[model samples]
Target: MHSASIVEAYTVTIWEMLAVFVAGISAGTINTIVGSGTLITFPVLLATGLPPVTATVSNALGLVSGSISGAIGYRAELAGQRRRVLRLSLIAAVGGITGAVLLLTLPPTAFETIVPVLVALALVLVVLQPRIARAVQRRRERTGSPAHPDGGPLLLVGLLLASVYGGYFTAAQGIVYIALMGMLINDTLQRLNAVKNVLAAVVNSIAALFFVFVAELDWTAVVLIAVGSAIGGQIGATYGRRLSPSVLRILIVVVGTFAIAQLLFRRFG
Candidate 1:
């Protein structure tokens, strides 16, 4: 009987580890390619029977590892965006910290209700991003402006808001960030995507650290996810550049739509 119990415990541990690894891999691929990995991992955590707040915190922590790996893989594209990144990073950091504090203070019922609404809004942004970018590009071409589309002020404001969302429960945070950057910068989609990864990593890392000390984290899941996501992130970032922007945009729309549908079904259906 004692041996049987020990074997069962080992089997459960292995299963949980595998689940985390799968979540990490999915997160890495989605984040690097289209940016909605949280939709996968967060639900998995919730399904594991964790409380909503704990799941969100653990998901955020695990995702940071993938984001950092993704960012580094896109370092070449990020080289020229240093100034914009620096100017915006602080705002994102502040927003993330503020969001984390708010999450800790908010009641569980409130957060449960608010998250699906936020997910739906994020889906709308993802759907509209490509068209908005085309419009911005057309305007830049019409005027023959030597200066890049300097949407810095607008970007700072958007990043602050997006970071707050990221810190709280980032399902489609990357789509929102990429959309804002596409509107504001004249850079190629690849480069803007690189910036998005780094900025997101910074915001998530900060929030994850806060939760590490203050919140009850699922360490087993965190470890497996962090390792798998890091590997998957590297793969996704490297291959993502070869993909056409239109294809990626379509993928984002599909993923965002699925996420919204799932959230709505869970909440109302």
Candidate 2:
């Protein structure tokens, strides 16, 4: 390449890297607060020309640090939840591994087809989260029965399924987790959010580890996201609660919509 072409190429590369880093920050913050961070980062990675599977794996791997950071930030709420965390963790791990295996085994075309649907589903879940919370609260008011301390088998099954999704796509996994636990476990939302972070960490870590061995990774993308997400995790932990849920939902919906469009274009356009 000529010197001018080399300079232009280098500039474009730097800008893309910067964009990925910013996406990571946004993703980590959102993941720490409400989940669906992948909706932010995955599209940016895809735009940078990564294949769908590579982008998903790299996003999962990069966000693990953010998950851990968010969990630590919520340690205060986690104080009495040891037994609960432990029980749910094993289930999450199994589901995560299962999902990861499915990702590896499935053909690339299957991923292209499935991911748009998954992103659409996750966007719907994000949009409906407030209603889901209110419904959960109403159920609490109507029922006089005490919550099952262990959340019973139903909770385990729900969490297992959510973890599998997290391991596969991880877009809105935290929303699904909080919804399930809120309905079944009878905890305050903050505490449930804390638990959500821990479980997210578990699922992300397990799936990332699995990918390290079997999947192709864009290591540069991974590093940029990891650093950015770690910072975003701290920001979310410190100030995320003060942010408006409506605003966050709007942002997630917008980004998710863009992602769906991009994926569809890649597949059919």
Number of the top TM-score candidate: 1
- Which regions of candidate 1 are displaced past 4 Å? 1-5, 109-150
True-structure RMSD, every candidate:
3.2, 3.9
Model 2: what TM-score?
0.81
- lDDT of candidate 2 over 171-243, digit per residue (tens): 7788777667765676666777788899999999999999999999999999999999998988888875555
lDDT, residue 45, model 2: 92
Report every candidate's CA lDDT: 0.78, 0.82
On the 0 to 100 scale, the lDDT of residue 95 in model 1 is 84
Give me the runs in candidate 2 sitting further than 4 Å from their true place.
1-4, 108-145, 243-269
- Candidate 1 C-alpha lDDT tens digits along 14-83: 7766787898898987898778798788777776667888888888898888999999999998887787
